[model samples]
Target: MSSDESQQRRGSYVPIDFTPEVSKQCLKQVEFYFSEFNFPYDKFLRMTAEKNDGWVPIGTIATFNRMKKFRPVEKVVEALRTSKILAVSEDGENVKRIEPLDLEGTKNARHERNKRTVAVMNFPHENVTNMTELQEKMEEFFGKLAQINQVRLRRERGRKFNGTVIVEFKDLPECEKFLKTYSGEDAETLSFEGRKLDVFTKKQFDLQREATRGKNFSGSGQKARSFTGHRKNMPQQEQKDENKEEQKEETSKEEETKVEDKD
Candidate 1:
Protein backbone atom coordinates (compact mmCIF):
# COMPACT_ATOMS: atom_id res chain seq x y z
CA MET A 1 0.00 0.00 0.00
CA SER A 2 1.12 3.53 -0.73
CA SER A 3 2.24 5.59 2.37
CA ASP A 4 -0.51 8.24 1.79
CA GLU A 5 -3.26 5.58 1.65
CA SER A 6 -1.98 3.96 4.90
CA GLN A 7 -2.10 7.34 6.69
CA GLN A 8 -5.67 7.94 5.48
CA ARG A 9 -6.93 4.53 6.81
CA ARG A 10 -5.24 5.06 10.20
CA GLY A 11 -6.85 8.49 10.56
CA SER A 12 -10.33 7.13 9.61
CA TYR A 13 -10.11 4.12 12.00
CA VAL A 14 -9.31 6.11 15.16
CA PRO A 15 -11.37 4.50 18.03
CA ILE A 16 -14.03 6.69 19.80
CA ASP A 17 -13.49 6.87 23.58
CA PHE A 18 -15.05 8.97 26.38
CA THR A 19 -12.80 11.78 27.54
CA PRO A 20 -12.13 12.37 31.27
CA GLU A 21 -14.52 15.38 31.30
CA VAL A 22 -17.36 13.29 29.78
CA SER A 23 -16.73 10.52 32.34
CA LYS A 24 -16.86 13.10 35.17
CA GLN A 25 -20.14 14.50 33.87
CA CYS A 26 -21.69 11.03 33.69
CA LEU A 27 -20.61 10.30 37.25
CA LYS A 28 -22.01 13.62 38.45
CA GLN A 29 -25.41 12.83 36.91
CA VAL A 30 -25.38 9.45 38.59
CA GLU A 31 -24.59 11.03 41.93
CA PHE A 32 -27.36 13.59 41.45
CA TYR A 33 -29.97 10.85 40.94
CA PHE A 34 -28.60 8.91 43.89
CA SER A 35 -28.98 11.96 46.15
CA GLU A 36 -32.42 12.74 44.70
CA PHE A 37 -33.82 9.30 45.60
CA ASN A 38 -32.18 9.32 49.04
CA PHE A 39 -30.62 5.97 48.10
CA PRO A 40 -27.35 4.79 49.58
CA TYR A 41 -24.32 5.09 47.30
CA ASP A 42 -23.97 1.30 46.85
CA LYS A 43 -27.65 0.69 46.05
CA PHE A 44 -27.70 3.73 43.78
CA LEU A 45 -24.80 2.31 41.78
CA ARG A 46 -26.60 -1.03 41.46
CA MET A 47 -29.87 0.53 40.37
CA THR A 48 -28.08 2.78 37.86
CA ALA A 49 -26.37 -0.22 36.29
CA GLU A 50 -29.59 -2.28 36.14
CA LYS A 51 -31.81 0.45 34.64
CA ASN A 52 -29.26 1.99 32.20
CA ASP A 53 -29.40 -0.88 29.62
CA GLY A 54 -25.74 -1.44 30.68
CA TRP A 55 -24.62 1.69 28.70
CA VAL A 56 -23.33 3.61 31.74
CA PRO A 57 -26.64 5.52 32.05
CA ILE A 58 -26.59 9.35 32.55
CA GLY A 59 -29.90 11.09 31.81
CA THR A 60 -33.56 11.63 32.86
CA ILE A 61 -34.48 7.95 32.51
CA ALA A 62 -32.16 6.88 35.30
CA THR A 63 -33.37 9.70 37.60
CA PHE A 64 -37.04 8.99 36.89
CA ASN A 65 -36.71 5.29 37.56
CA ARG A 66 -34.90 5.96 40.81
CA MET A 67 -37.60 8.42 41.93
CA LYS A 68 -40.36 5.96 41.03
CA LYS A 69 -38.80 3.15 43.07
CA PHE A 70 -37.99 5.34 46.07
CA ARG A 71 -41.50 6.75 46.61
CA PRO A 72 -43.21 6.36 50.02
CA VAL A 73 -45.22 3.23 49.02
CA GLU A 74 -42.37 1.64 47.07
CA LYS A 75 -38.86 0.38 47.98
CA VAL A 76 -38.24 3.53 50.07
CA VAL A 77 -39.82 1.88 53.15
CA GLU A 78 -37.41 -1.06 52.96
CA ALA A 79 -34.50 1.31 52.35
CA LEU A 80 -35.46 3.37 55.41
CA ARG A 81 -35.66 0.19 57.57
CA THR A 82 -32.14 -0.74 56.41
CA SER A 83 -30.94 2.89 56.97
CA LYS A 84 -30.28 3.28 53.26
CA ILE A 85 -32.70 6.24 52.75
CA LEU A 86 -32.82 9.52 54.66
CA ALA A 87 -36.30 10.09 56.07
CA VAL A 88 -37.48 13.64 56.71
CA SER A 89 -40.78 14.48 58.38
CA GLU A 90 -42.74 17.66 58.72
CA ASP A 91 -44.06 18.32 62.22
CA GLY A 92 -43.46 14.60 62.99
CA GLU A 93 -46.50 13.66 60.95
CA ASN A 94 -45.66 12.96 57.30
CA VAL A 95 -42.22 11.55 56.76
CA LYS A 96 -40.53 12.38 53.43
CA ARG A 97 -37.88 9.80 52.64
CA ILE A 98 -35.65 11.35 50.00
CA GLU A 99 -32.31 13.05 49.40
CA PRO A 100 -31.67 16.17 51.46
CA LEU A 101 -30.21 17.89 48.38
CA ASP A 102 -33.54 17.68 46.54
CA LEU A 103 -35.33 21.04 46.00
CA GLU A 104 -38.67 20.04 47.52
CA GLY A 105 -39.66 23.51 48.82
CA THR A 106 -38.06 25.52 46.01
CA LYS A 107 -41.23 26.45 44.10
CA ASN A 108 -43.17 27.59 47.17
CA ALA A 109 -40.22 29.54 48.58
CA ARG A 110 -39.59 31.30 45.26
CA HIS A 111 -43.26 32.32 44.98
CA GLU A 112 -43.33 33.77 48.49
CA ARG A 113 -40.00 35.55 48.12
CA ASN A 114 -41.04 37.22 44.83
CA LYS A 115 -43.76 39.36 46.40
CA ARG A 116 -43.64 43.20 45.80
CA THR A 117 -44.27 46.24 48.03
CA VAL A 118 -46.12 49.58 47.85
CA ALA A 119 -44.11 52.71 47.01
CA VAL A 120 -44.28 56.42 46.18
CA MET A 121 -45.22 57.30 42.57
CA ASN A 122 -44.36 60.53 40.78
CA PHE A 123 -46.78 61.79 38.12
CA PRO A 124 -44.91 64.28 35.98
CA HIS A 125 -46.95 64.13 32.79
CA GLU A 126 -50.35 65.25 34.00
CA ASN A 127 -50.64 69.03 33.87
CA VAL A 128 -50.51 69.63 37.61
CA THR A 129 -49.33 73.21 37.96
CA ASN A 130 -49.66 73.54 41.73
CA MET A 131 -49.10 71.38 44.81
CA THR A 132 -52.80 71.30 45.72
CA GLU A 133 -53.73 69.88 42.33
CA LEU A 134 -50.98 67.30 42.55
CA GLN A 135 -52.12 66.21 45.99
CA GLU A 136 -55.74 66.00 44.88
CA LYS A 137 -54.85 63.78 41.94
CA MET A 138 -52.72 61.51 44.11
CA GLU A 139 -55.53 61.12 46.63
CA GLU A 140 -57.91 60.32 43.83
CA PHE A 141 -55.59 57.66 42.43
CA PHE A 142 -54.76 56.04 45.79
CA GLY A 143 -58.37 56.14 46.99
CA LYS A 144 -58.89 52.83 45.22
CA LEU A 145 -56.33 51.12 47.47
CA ALA A 146 -58.41 50.30 50.54
CA GLN A 147 -55.33 48.92 52.25
CA ILE A 148 -53.52 52.26 52.19
CA ASN A 149 -53.47 53.80 55.68
CA GLN A 150 -52.17 57.26 54.80
CA VAL A 151 -50.79 59.26 51.87
CA ARG A 152 -48.52 62.29 52.12
CA LEU A 153 -48.14 64.17 48.81
CA ARG A 154 -45.87 67.07 47.86
CA ARG A 155 -44.42 68.86 44.83
CA GLU A 156 -40.89 70.19 44.18
CA ARG A 157 -40.22 73.35 42.16
CA GLY A 158 -37.04 73.52 40.09
CA ARG A 159 -35.96 73.78 36.46
CA LYS A 160 -37.81 70.49 36.08
CA PHE A 161 -40.96 70.25 38.21
CA ASN A 162 -41.44 66.97 40.06
CA GLY A 163 -43.96 65.58 42.56
CA THR A 164 -43.28 63.18 45.43
CA VAL A 165 -45.92 61.09 47.18
CA ILE A 166 -45.53 58.81 50.21
CA VAL A 167 -47.92 55.93 50.77
CA GLU A 168 -47.97 54.18 54.17
CA PHE A 169 -49.67 50.84 54.64
CA LYS A 170 -50.72 48.83 57.68
CA ASP A 171 -48.13 46.14 56.94
CA LEU A 172 -45.82 44.62 54.37
CA PRO A 173 -48.44 42.14 53.19
CA GLU A 174 -50.88 44.92 52.45
CA CYS A 175 -48.17 46.79 50.56
CA GLU A 176 -47.40 43.70 48.53
CA LYS A 177 -51.06 43.20 47.74
CA PHE A 178 -51.33 46.78 46.49
CA LEU A 179 -48.28 46.37 44.27
CA LYS A 180 -49.71 43.21 42.76
CA THR A 181 -52.97 44.96 42.02
CA TYR A 182 -51.57 48.18 40.52
CA SER A 183 -48.01 47.54 39.41
CA GLY A 184 -48.80 47.14 35.71
CA GLU A 185 -52.09 48.88 35.03
CA ASP A 186 -53.05 51.67 32.61
CA ALA A 187 -55.11 53.65 35.13
CA GLU A 188 -52.18 53.63 37.50
CA THR A 189 -50.17 55.55 34.91
CA LEU A 190 -50.03 59.22 35.89
CA SER A 191 -48.76 62.33 34.11
CA PHE A 192 -47.68 65.77 35.34
CA GLU A 193 -45.40 68.57 34.05
CA GLY A 194 -44.50 66.68 30.86
CA ARG A 195 -42.99 63.68 32.68
CA LYS A 196 -44.38 60.19 33.11
CA LEU A 197 -45.17 58.72 36.52
CA ASP A 198 -42.21 57.03 38.21
CA VAL A 199 -42.97 54.53 41.00
CA PHE A 200 -40.35 53.51 43.56
CA THR A 201 -40.11 51.89 46.99
CA LYS A 202 -39.59 53.73 50.28
CA LYS A 203 -36.06 52.40 50.31
CA GLN A 204 -35.45 53.89 46.90
CA PHE A 205 -36.74 57.23 48.11
CA ASP A 206 -34.34 57.17 51.07
CA LEU A 207 -31.46 56.15 48.83
CA GLN A 208 -32.14 59.06 46.48
CA ARG A 209 -32.36 61.50 49.50
CA GLU A 210 -35.80 62.69 48.41
CA ALA A 211 -37.72 61.71 51.54
CA THR A 212 -37.79 65.00 53.50
CA ARG A 213 -38.01 67.34 50.52
CA GLY A 214 -41.29 69.05 49.51
CA LYS A 215 -43.10 68.31 52.77
CA ASN A 216 -46.49 69.83 53.67
CA PHE A 217 -45.00 71.95 56.43
CA SER A 218 -47.41 74.88 56.19
CA GLY A 219 -50.55 72.74 56.30
CA SER A 220 -49.41 70.07 58.74
CA GLY A 221 -47.40 72.10 61.26
CA GLN A 222 -48.30 75.79 61.92
CA LYS A 223 -51.72 76.13 60.33
CA ALA A 224 -53.48 74.35 63.19
CA ARG A 225 -51.68 76.51 65.78
CA SER A 226 -52.60 79.74 64.00
CA PHE A 227 -56.26 78.82 63.73
CA THR A 228 -56.44 77.78 67.39
CA GLY A 229 -54.73 80.98 68.58
CA HIS A 230 -57.08 83.16 66.55
CA ARG A 231 -60.10 81.33 67.90
CA LYS A 232 -58.93 81.70 71.54
CA ASN A 233 -58.27 85.47 71.32
CA MET A 234 -61.59 86.09 69.49
CA PRO A 235 -63.81 84.72 72.31
CA GLN A 236 -61.98 86.68 75.11
CA GLN A 237 -62.09 89.98 73.15
CA GLU A 238 -65.79 89.55 72.42
CA GLN A 239 -66.51 88.92 76.13
CA LYS A 240 -64.71 92.15 77.22
CA ASP A 241 -66.69 94.24 74.73
CA GLU A 242 -69.96 92.67 75.88
CA ASN A 243 -69.17 93.46 79.57
CA LYS A 244 -68.47 97.14 78.76
CA GLU A 245 -71.79 97.49 76.97
CA GLU A 246 -73.65 95.97 79.92
CA GLN A 247 -72.04 98.40 82.41
CA LYS A 248 -73.05 101.42 80.28
CA GLU A 249 -76.67 100.17 80.09
CA GLU A 250 -76.79 99.74 83.91
CA THR A 251 -75.44 103.31 84.58
CA SER A 252 -77.95 104.87 82.16
CA LYS A 253 -80.83 103.03 83.85
CA GLU A 254 -79.73 104.28 87.35
CA GLU A 255 -79.47 107.93 86.18
CA GLU A 256 -82.96 107.84 84.63
CA THR A 257 -84.42 106.35 87.83
CA LYS A 258 -82.88 109.13 90.03
CA VAL A 259 -84.17 111.92 87.71
CA GLU A 260 -87.72 110.48 87.83
CA ASP A 261 -87.58 110.32 91.65
CA LYS A 262 -86.49 114.03 91.84
CA ASP A 263 -89.23 115.13 89.48
Candidate 2:
Protein backbone atom coordinates (compact mmCIF):
# COMPACT_ATOMS: atom_id res chain seq x y z
CA MET A 1 0.00 0.00 0.00
CA SER A 2 1.03 3.61 -0.60
CA SER A 3 2.29 5.88 2.19
CA ASP A 4 -0.87 8.02 1.95
CA GLU A 5 -3.07 4.96 2.40
CA SER A 6 -0.95 3.84 5.34
CA GLN A 7 -1.28 7.25 6.99
CA GLN A 8 -5.02 7.26 6.31
CA ARG A 9 -5.39 3.84 7.94
CA ARG A 10 -3.41 5.09 10.94
CA GLY A 11 -5.91 7.97 11.24
CA SER A 12 -3.26 10.60 10.67
CA TYR A 13 -4.56 14.19 10.69
CA VAL A 14 -2.09 15.42 8.05
CA PRO A 15 -3.98 16.27 4.89
CA ILE A 16 -2.57 14.18 2.03
CA ASP A 17 -4.09 16.42 -0.59
CA PHE A 18 -5.87 19.77 -0.68
CA THR A 19 -8.52 18.40 -3.01
CA PRO A 20 -12.01 19.90 -3.31
CA GLU A 21 -13.42 16.98 -1.34
CA VAL A 22 -10.91 17.66 1.46
CA SER A 23 -11.88 21.31 1.31
CA LYS A 24 -15.56 20.37 1.58
CA GLN A 25 -14.80 18.20 4.60
CA CYS A 26 -12.81 21.07 6.09
CA LEU A 27 -15.76 23.39 5.56
CA LYS A 28 -18.09 21.03 7.40
CA GLN A 29 -15.63 20.58 10.28
CA VAL A 30 -15.04 24.30 10.67
CA GLU A 31 -18.76 25.06 10.41
CA PHE A 32 -19.59 22.43 13.02
CA TYR A 33 -17.02 23.90 15.40
CA PHE A 34 -18.99 27.12 15.23
CA SER A 35 -22.35 25.35 15.10
CA GLU A 36 -24.98 25.65 17.84
CA PHE A 37 -24.64 21.92 18.59
CA ASN A 38 -20.98 22.39 19.51
CA PHE A 39 -20.40 26.08 20.22
CA PRO A 40 -22.17 26.30 23.56
CA TYR A 41 -20.22 23.36 24.96
CA ASP A 42 -16.83 24.55 23.75
CA LYS A 43 -15.74 26.81 26.61
CA PHE A 44 -12.47 28.08 25.16
CA LEU A 45 -14.03 28.86 21.79
CA ARG A 46 -16.94 30.66 23.41
CA MET A 47 -14.59 32.69 25.60
CA THR A 48 -12.34 33.56 22.66
CA ALA A 49 -15.37 34.59 20.57
CA GLU A 50 -16.66 36.70 23.46
CA LYS A 51 -13.38 38.67 23.56
CA ASN A 52 -13.45 39.45 19.82
CA ASP A 53 -17.15 40.10 19.16
CA GLY A 54 -17.70 36.50 18.08
CA TRP A 55 -14.70 36.66 15.70
CA VAL A 56 -12.07 33.98 16.43
CA PRO A 57 -8.69 34.19 14.83
CA ILE A 58 -8.24 31.48 12.19
CA GLY A 59 -4.74 30.84 13.53
CA THR A 60 -6.12 30.36 17.00
CA ILE A 61 -8.78 27.99 15.63
CA ALA A 62 -6.09 26.04 13.82
CA THR A 63 -4.38 25.51 17.18
CA PHE A 64 -7.47 23.92 18.72
CA ASN A 65 -6.96 20.33 19.98
CA ARG A 66 -9.66 18.94 17.70
CA MET A 67 -8.59 21.15 14.77
CA LYS A 68 -5.02 19.83 14.80
CA LYS A 69 -5.60 17.72 11.68
CA PHE A 70 -7.12 20.71 9.86
CA ARG A 71 -3.69 22.32 10.40
CA PRO A 72 -2.03 25.24 8.64
CA VAL A 73 -4.29 28.23 9.12
CA GLU A 74 -4.26 28.99 5.39
CA LYS A 75 -6.02 25.73 4.51
CA VAL A 76 -8.82 26.35 7.06
CA VAL A 77 -9.17 29.94 5.88
CA GLU A 78 -9.34 28.83 2.23
CA ALA A 79 -11.87 26.10 2.97
CA LEU A 80 -14.10 28.51 4.91
CA ARG A 81 -13.95 31.20 2.21
CA THR A 82 -16.80 29.58 0.30
CA SER A 83 -18.94 28.89 3.37
CA LYS A 84 -22.41 30.40 3.27
CA ILE A 85 -23.03 30.54 7.04
CA LEU A 86 -19.52 31.69 7.99
CA ALA A 87 -17.83 35.02 7.36
CA VAL A 88 -14.17 35.12 6.49
CA SER A 89 -12.28 38.29 7.41
CA GLU A 90 -11.11 40.42 4.49
CA ASP A 91 -7.50 39.67 5.41
CA GLY A 92 -8.46 36.00 6.10
CA GLU A 93 -7.01 36.34 9.60
CA ASN A 94 -10.23 35.46 11.36
CA VAL A 95 -13.58 33.63 10.98
CA LYS A 96 -17.03 33.97 12.55
CA ARG A 97 -20.53 32.67 12.11
CA ILE A 98 -22.59 35.08 10.04
CA GLU A 99 -25.70 34.41 12.04
CA PRO A 100 -25.43 35.39 15.70
CA LEU A 101 -25.73 32.57 18.21
CA ASP A 102 -29.32 31.95 19.16
CA LEU A 103 -29.11 30.91 22.81
CA GLU A 104 -32.87 30.59 23.31
CA GLY A 105 -33.24 28.53 20.15
CA THR A 106 -30.50 26.15 21.30
CA LYS A 107 -32.13 25.79 24.72
CA ASN A 108 -35.49 24.91 23.17
CA ALA A 109 -33.88 22.51 20.72
CA ARG A 110 -32.06 20.54 23.45
CA HIS A 111 -35.31 19.15 24.89
CA GLU A 112 -36.26 17.49 21.63
CA ARG A 113 -32.65 16.45 21.06
CA ASN A 114 -32.55 14.56 24.37
CA LYS A 115 -35.64 12.57 23.38
CA ARG A 116 -33.96 11.39 20.17
CA THR A 117 -30.57 10.49 21.63
CA VAL A 118 -29.14 6.98 22.25
CA ALA A 119 -26.07 5.67 24.05
CA VAL A 120 -23.87 3.06 22.37
CA MET A 121 -21.05 1.03 23.87
CA ASN A 122 -18.39 -1.63 23.09
CA PHE A 123 -16.52 0.36 20.45
CA PRO A 124 -13.00 -0.64 19.34
CA HIS A 125 -11.57 2.29 21.28
CA GLU A 126 -7.98 1.09 21.04
CA ASN A 127 -7.98 1.17 17.24
CA VAL A 128 -8.52 4.93 16.86
CA THR A 129 -6.79 7.45 19.09
CA ASN A 130 -7.90 10.67 17.45
CA MET A 131 -11.35 11.64 18.73
CA THR A 132 -12.17 13.56 15.56
CA GLU A 133 -11.55 10.47 13.43
CA LEU A 134 -13.54 8.27 15.77
CA GLN A 135 -16.41 10.74 15.75
CA GLU A 136 -16.40 10.84 11.95
CA LYS A 137 -16.30 7.05 11.77
CA MET A 138 -19.22 6.79 14.18
CA GLU A 139 -21.18 9.34 12.16
CA GLU A 140 -20.57 7.38 8.94
CA PHE A 141 -21.35 4.01 10.52
CA PHE A 142 -24.60 5.15 12.11
CA GLY A 143 -25.44 7.42 9.21
CA LYS A 144 -26.41 4.27 7.34
CA LEU A 145 -28.85 3.46 10.16
CA ALA A 146 -30.61 6.80 10.54
CA GLN A 147 -30.45 10.55 9.98
CA ILE A 148 -28.15 11.66 12.81
CA ASN A 149 -27.89 15.15 14.12
CA GLN A 150 -24.53 14.38 15.72
CA VAL A 151 -22.39 11.66 17.34
CA ARG A 152 -20.70 12.58 20.63
CA LEU A 153 -17.80 10.47 21.83
CA ARG A 154 -17.96 9.81 25.54
CA ARG A 155 -14.70 10.40 27.36
CA GLU A 156 -13.32 9.33 30.71
CA ARG A 157 -10.48 10.54 32.95
CA GLY A 158 -7.61 12.34 31.16
CA ARG A 159 -9.89 12.89 28.15
CA LYS A 160 -9.59 9.27 27.01
CA PHE A 161 -12.25 7.65 24.85
CA ASN A 162 -14.32 5.25 27.00
CA GLY A 163 -15.65 2.95 24.29
CA THR A 164 -19.03 4.60 24.37
CA VAL A 165 -20.86 7.27 22.40
CA ILE A 166 -24.15 9.06 22.29
CA VAL A 167 -25.81 9.52 18.92
CA GLU A 168 -28.51 12.10 18.46
CA PHE A 169 -30.88 11.50 15.55
CA LYS A 170 -32.70 14.25 13.66
CA ASP A 171 -36.11 13.12 14.95
CA LEU A 172 -37.84 10.77 17.37
CA PRO A 173 -39.12 8.35 14.72
CA GLU A 174 -35.66 7.71 13.29
CA CYS A 175 -34.22 7.39 16.80
CA GLU A 176 -36.88 4.86 17.79
CA LYS A 177 -36.42 2.95 14.56
CA PHE A 178 -32.66 2.66 15.06
CA LEU A 179 -33.14 1.49 18.64
CA LYS A 180 -35.71 -1.13 17.61
CA THR A 181 -33.35 -2.44 14.94
CA TYR A 182 -30.09 -2.61 16.92
CA SER A 183 -30.90 -2.86 20.62
CA GLY A 184 -32.37 -5.50 23.00
CA GLU A 185 -32.52 -8.92 21.35
CA ASP A 186 -30.31 -7.81 18.45
CA ALA A 187 -27.64 -6.13 20.61
CA GLU A 188 -25.40 -9.19 20.77
CA THR A 189 -25.34 -9.42 16.98
CA LEU A 190 -24.67 -5.68 16.52
CA SER A 191 -20.99 -5.02 15.98
CA PHE A 192 -18.81 -2.03 15.09
CA GLU A 193 -15.28 -2.62 13.86
CA GLY A 194 -15.74 -6.30 14.80
CA ARG A 195 -16.57 -5.52 18.45
CA LYS A 196 -20.06 -6.27 19.71
CA LEU A 197 -22.01 -3.09 20.56
CA ASP A 198 -24.69 -2.35 23.11
CA VAL A 199 -27.21 0.37 22.40
CA PHE A 200 -29.66 2.03 24.81
CA THR A 201 -31.97 4.99 24.67
CA LYS A 202 -30.98 8.02 26.72
CA LYS A 203 -33.68 7.20 29.30
CA GLN A 204 -32.56 3.60 29.55
CA PHE A 205 -28.95 4.62 29.96
CA ASP A 206 -29.86 7.08 32.71
CA LEU A 207 -31.92 4.48 34.54
CA GLN A 208 -29.12 1.92 34.36
CA ARG A 209 -26.64 4.50 35.66
CA GLU A 210 -28.98 5.43 38.50
CA ALA A 211 -29.50 1.81 39.39
CA THR A 212 -25.76 1.20 39.48
CA ARG A 213 -25.29 4.25 41.67
CA GLY A 214 -28.01 2.98 44.01
CA LYS A 215 -26.25 -0.35 44.35
CA ASN A 216 -22.97 1.35 45.21
CA PHE A 217 -24.66 3.64 47.71
CA SER A 218 -26.44 0.65 49.26
CA GLY A 219 -23.12 -1.14 49.72
CA SER A 220 -21.65 1.89 51.46
CA GLY A 221 -24.73 2.12 53.68
CA GLN A 222 -24.40 -1.52 54.60
CA LYS A 223 -20.80 -0.97 55.60
CA ALA A 224 -21.87 1.98 57.75
CA ARG A 225 -24.58 -0.09 59.40
CA SER A 226 -22.06 -2.84 60.08
CA PHE A 227 -19.73 -0.28 61.67
CA THR A 228 -22.57 0.84 63.95
CA GLY A 229 -23.34 -2.75 64.79
CA HIS A 230 -19.72 -3.30 65.70
CA ARG A 231 -19.86 -0.33 68.06
CA LYS A 232 -23.01 -1.73 69.65
CA ASN A 233 -21.19 -5.01 70.21
CA MET A 234 -18.31 -3.29 72.01
CA PRO A 235 -16.88 -4.95 75.19
CA GLN A 236 -18.82 -4.83 78.49
CA GLN A 237 -16.20 -2.50 80.02
CA GLU A 238 -16.67 0.08 77.24
CA GLN A 239 -20.47 -0.12 77.63
CA LYS A 240 -20.17 0.42 81.36
CA ASP A 241 -17.98 3.49 80.79
CA GLU A 242 -20.55 4.97 78.38
CA ASN A 243 -23.44 4.25 80.83
CA LYS A 244 -21.53 5.86 83.70
CA GLU A 245 -20.80 8.97 81.64
CA GLU A 246 -24.50 9.30 80.83
CA GLN A 247 -25.52 8.88 84.49
CA LYS A 248 -23.02 11.51 85.67
CA GLU A 249 -24.32 14.02 83.08
CA GLU A 250 -27.93 13.43 84.26
CA THR A 251 -26.90 13.84 87.95
CA SER A 252 -25.11 17.13 87.19
CA LYS A 253 -28.28 18.45 85.44
CA GLU A 254 -30.44 17.40 88.40
CA GLU A 255 -28.15 19.19 90.88
CA GLU A 256 -28.19 22.35 88.76
CA THR A 257 -32.02 22.28 88.71
CA LYS A 258 -32.11 21.90 92.51
CA VAL A 259 -29.75 24.87 92.95
CA GLU A 260 -31.91 27.03 90.63
CA ASP A 261 -35.09 26.12 92.60
CA LYS A 262 -33.39 26.92 95.92
CA ASP A 263 -32.44 30.40 94.57
lDDT by residue (1-263, candidate 2, tens digit) is 99999965554356556788878877887798788777765656788899999999987666555566675557778899999999999999989999988865775566577789887766766545666566667778988878987887755434556566778898899998888888764443678767666676765544443334324211123322332223332233322354554454233223211001111
Top of the candidates by TM-score: 2
Q: In angstroms, how far off is 211's CA in candidate 2?
A: 4.5
Best by lDDT: 2
User: Which residue runs of candidate 1 sit more than 4 Å off their true CA positions?
Assistant: 1-118, 125-127, 157-161, 182-196, 210-263
lDDT of each: 0.37, 0.65
Clashes of 1: 7
Assess the local accuracy of residue 221 in candidate 1 as a C-alpha lDDT between 0 and 100: 30
Error of 1 at 68 (Å): 76
Candidate 1, run of 10 with poorest lDDT: 254-263
Roughly what TM-score does model 1 have, to 2 decimal places?
0.28
lDDT by residue (1-263, candidate 1, tens digit) is 99999975543322223344543433332343334222222233435445643222222222332232222222232222333333323222222234343343542332232233234444442454544344446656676665654454433333122345566564678776665555544436444445454455544333233223244322123322322223332222222354554453233223211001111
